[model samples]
Target: MPDWNRRSVLATGAALSTTGILAAVGSTVAEEDASTEGVATGDPPGWSSVHGNAANSRYLPLDDGFPEPNTIAWRSDTLYGVSNDGDIAVVDGRIYIVGEFESTDYEQTELRVASTDDGTLEWKTEVTGRQRPTVADGTVYVSGVDRVTAFDTEDGSLQWVREFDSEQWISNATAADGEIYVVTGGTRFNADATLYALDGEDGSIQWKRKQVEARQENRETADPAPVGFKSAPVAVANGSVYAITGGGEFKGSGSKPGLQWNGGVTALDAKTGEKQWGVVLEDGAFIKIIATDAFVCVQNMPDGLEETVLDSETGETVLTSNSTRAATADVRVTHDTFRPSSGPITVSTYGTDDSWTASDIYYFPPLIAGDTLIATRTSESSIVGFDLESGTEKWNWEFDGTPHALAGVDENTLYFKLYKADRPTELIALRASDDRGEGREGDDRDETEPDDDTEDGSDESDSDC
Candidate 1:
């Protein structure tokens, strides 16, 4: 399973220069003094950013108080070897993770920041690359294989760092209104993608967008497909951003070999990089986007998993849904590979196909929590949930190991990550039960209704100001 373009040049380093570390990390910090200590009232202030807000629509209307028979309201284990693409960020009460381990003499990556109530710690720092932690306004946006720091959620220090001159990598990052939205490139097979828009206080840049130069109608032996960027740029509320671009690896000419391709969905203008519309998919390549202040939901891949919904103001398209829901859920899950254990998982509802199964063994991709629709199991350690209108199940939660980052859900809490092989990577939190009396019962519905008729509306995009 290596070959994420050869582990993307094994996560490089050295690049910070946009005014050399933004005047050595100091200025930008006042969003009302980045509070929470002042705490007051209001609901959606928990899962602070990254998929939970900014219209990435990882969904979280909060209030049910999550953790129903799901147990474990705390568990830190001090974070040992946590990198299955590490990620967890829940501001105000604080959480922010990102790990990696191996000591004797190499591989590090730290960045802790704990305490969502009990699992204390408060600060750690180390860091190098494996991008993921993104909390905004008070700041805390990291990204490595090249550079893009910016901490200080109140204590974690280091306020600015930019880097990136070429050997790209960046990827996962997104903050709103004050701006952040990263996405770099070059993981070998045709690198070179860009898309900046920094300044969430001081990282600087504001608008970059570069990746549009692949056109070769067989210039004798064919060779012009390396256009980069395949994920990471979701701002949506109408001010725009959206992102996704691919179609690289083609290299075959004498014996015909290399092939890897697929890309499309652009949108830009989150302040003025312009280009407000772009589509591309005729077959696959656009594995997930979300957006929603009314529409933008793409999915597209291998042909049958098509979900299209655009129109976040003018990107057009409207409603497509070949079936695939989970983060917005009207209910839909067929299953062949989100891990697949022995097969059969089905579920169905997004336009019919009439399904129901649930044979177990999923690896993640099915989370709605409230009326339930969880599904975790990629070979045990458990997590069922179901009942999004009677798929049944209702409660399951087993856990001892092997969960690794589900992170998303908060009306009571449901963050995740667990390891086992020698221990160390805990984090958990669970605690979200809607009270079907006690456990396993079914038919409850109404976590806030609106299962899917589209048009729910919310992202007027001042980056969610």
Candidate 2:
């Protein structure tokens, strides 16, 4: 298993200059009827946020089936100087992007919006630091090194800006209901971690919760010890904020070893900054959290990956699996390799225990679209989709350049980008096929399918890459 670090896990995508493109393309903002306070505007019927929606399920329910091979609908013109890590956020017809653009004289980060039909540059705003943009209620929210700003979705005008007093780094904003939730932490070692809830309309601070505190008992001899939020971003569901907080001391000349780290999930009321329940994950670091209708799945890395599913109402453990990283209501992706360069990736169904029925080897995380599990081949510019139930290869597609990120997917299209260091980034949109064939039957399969095979054991299969 490869060791995962904070930087690699939260690394964002980059963008290129639209200096001339913005001038050539002309657009008008669509006027939407105003809704009551605390009510968020609806995202278009597709993949809106990075995690699909506010619950961070990363599951897209498309009735029109998944994308098939060799179904290219259109490809946007290459955008030069865009980083390989930059991502796109789609709302209605608007596509929001954040990335660093480099020119001969200088380099700067930018927030841009483009049209979904033609990928035309609508507007661009210069920003500091790079973080993925979040859109809701006709507004775009962006976070920087020490502040969070909101811009009008229509005109690219600054609506509100909220700054922090201390040197703090803010994570991506999760907007839901009528509030925006963000996790923040101190820049210095052992600094405190905080979660802030701001108004969606005016950016006013409604409530703030301190999750962890900084501590330095032996400042002179021991390394600075800090504790704070360690997860990538916070997940909100059932009127609650789901996040993790933990910290450990760096091993120094005189610091006490093995006594510095602990973490767990802490649930708080979304309306007020009050604690509901907390579970301590002793000797484990909380890596990710995904909230769904049935459970709140948490990824804890003590040695390898350990996924725990807890009841949404009561934080009780309902199911547990080893090496499981991604999950939907029916299927899970698990493997022993931490940074798998070329190894088996298990596709399993779980009820109380996991049943590894299918396998593949991929460098990036697999995405579940409807009943199919899609993944990119390890060290190759190809992607394959597999049926979750029958373990059959449904479709495969090869790209001209190395695929960088799976931007998103909607009912009729799958969006992704290709990378070539000397060339501009190529954004491609593929038409999703409506013919699901036999795989559509797996969607209604029982959660507790037969597990006659060995429990928690993976099937050895040859790589088809």
Candidate 3:
């Protein structure tokens, strides 16, 4: 049985929009006038998307100066209260983003938008859910509590909205050509993992592929099973969308042994939700793909876990390695019944702890800029970058606070936002270059310091709870 919320989809999106924290600089609103120019101000200076580009390259070109050591550019304060892990997009110069924050009044989540220029307000349409916004066809696409929506980028006007029967926890949206794709799932026991394609212009349903249940069983609780798509699907030039899903409850038993439920990649026809190919991965394997002329850099597990790269066309194994990183999931048991499991379960072969241990990470999707693949890794404490082509660790930049949001801008810069860290949540810039001359600063760009004349907009002044 599927858990469908009875609330109106519009109401849910409106609800999620108001909740969730989307911090930019984490600083309070200063007295000075903040710029709302965002990317419109000029060249995008930091991580533009979570994986950086549609290619999901956490990698950036190091020829010039990008992510160089410790260099902060313009650090603008973000919307006060909301929290955001939503990937960013740069269009028409403005940096459009949706973040969630705890509302002090009702202790609910709030979504807001800030400028990339000086971090000024650009009209934030409040909606619910943690799904990131996918900007395409001149419209902004996002998932709320129970639906996908498209908003006019020019005036933040509502273009069209489509509702779903289930709730979407932290999903991601992808778009190519004229179609918008969305994946929905959450921490609840519902594992209806399915993919949806909506018209890019009017938000009509192009197609919906009901995900098949995995042949695995629950290792812990026998009460209910977890299902649904947790990862965002990547759109390819081959006219298909790629993504992963957890197979839930084979034979009506939630848990399974061996590779039955670990996970796998499913390719769907873009025009019509047709299944192209599906591959079941090893017991603990996860897959990520990077497109290239030679081959798509299908990074297997980024952690010490092993991974096999398959040919994009035929889904044939091309490369295999156990040295990559894959995102870690917290499928542990908690005191509350609402928690995922009834006991401590291993989400990955890697040890199940919060540390940066090889097992506690998910290598961010690699960024493909020019001939380079920029890759990044994240945890509650640090954010690091690596070169996709050589698998060389270009740089490892640590964050004082845990970052819920991260994205790559170009070959030379990576952008990220930190919360509960030392300073106000910040949107810091790193120079990606190799010409660090010893004592010389790795990044020549001046750090983004608050202007003296601006108002004292501190993080404390943030919205509500």
Q: Each candidate's TM vs. the true structure?
A: 0.32, 0.70, 0.57
User: What is candidate 2's lDDT per residue for 70-111, written digit by digit as tens?
Assistant: 455455543322445326677777777766644232224666
Error of 1 at 464 (Å): 14
| Residue 157 alpha-carbon offset, candidate 2, angstroms | 1.9
lDDT of 1 by residue, 1-465 (tens): 111110111111122213223433555522222211211112135565546665555555445524455445555565433454225777777777766543332224656676565555656556566566788778777787667777777666676677776455577677766777777665422325677767777777755656543323224355434354564555545456677666643321211134333555666555545554454544334535776444566665533345555555444464555434344434444444433233445665543456676765454455565566666765566777776667877677776667755675556656666667886555556665433122221212311211122321222221111
Candidate 1 regions exceeding 4 Å error are 1-88, 91-115, 118-139, 142-151, 155-194, 197-209, 212-243, 246-284, 287-298, 301-304, 307-364, 367-429, 432-465
Q: 75-134 in candidate 3: lDDT tens per residue?
A: 445532334443666544455665654334321333444444434555565555445556
Reference-based TM-score, model 3: 0.57
Model 2 pairs whose backbones collide = 1-338, 2-338, 2-339, 12-85, 13-85, 13-86, 14-86, 38-178, 190-225, 190-226
lDDT of 2 at 454: 19
Model 2 misplacement above 4 A? 1-45, 67-69, 76-83, 103-108, 187-191, 212-231, 247-261, 302-309, 318-325, 350-358, 388-390, 421-424, 433-465
Models ranked on lDDT: 2, 1, 3
Task: Choose 1 or 2, whichever is better by TM-score.
Answer: 2
